[model samples]
Target: MGNIVKSLESSLATGNLQKMSETMDQFEKQFVNMEVQAEFMESAMAGSTSLSTPEGE
Candidate 1:
């Protein structure tokens, strides 16, 4: 993510629209992957907690 932002800044400074667009595409893909992983982790944590609870409480 940091590398992508740095590349985007470099592209903007050099006025290279193509490189900027490619960097943005890469950032978008990385962001979506992080979101999916977060959701899966949250679901796994919830499942584990539910299974560890005492029967009457």
Candidate 2:
């Protein structure tokens, strides 16, 4: 993420539209992947919590 931001800033400083666009695309893909992983983790945690709880309480 930091790398992507740095790349974007560098591209902007150098007036490289193509590099900026590519960096943005890469960032978007990484963002989407992170979201998916987060959702999966949340679901896995929820499942574990339920399994560990007492049957009646």
Which residue window of length 10 is worst by lDDT in model 2? 48-57
32: Cα error in model 1, Å: 0.4
* Candidate 1 residue-wise lDDT at 25: 96
List residue ranges in candidate 2 displaced over 4 A.
none
Candidate 1 structure quality by residue, lDDT tens digits, 1-57: 999989999999999999999999999999999999999999999999999998897
Per-residue lDDT of candidate 2, residues 1-57 (tens digit): 999999999999999999999999999999999999999999999999999999997
Q: Give one clash count per candidate, in the order shown.
A: 0, 0
Superposition TM-score, candidate 2 onto the true structure: 0.94
- List per-prediction Cα lDDT, in the order shown: 0.97, 0.99
lDDT winner among the candidates? 2
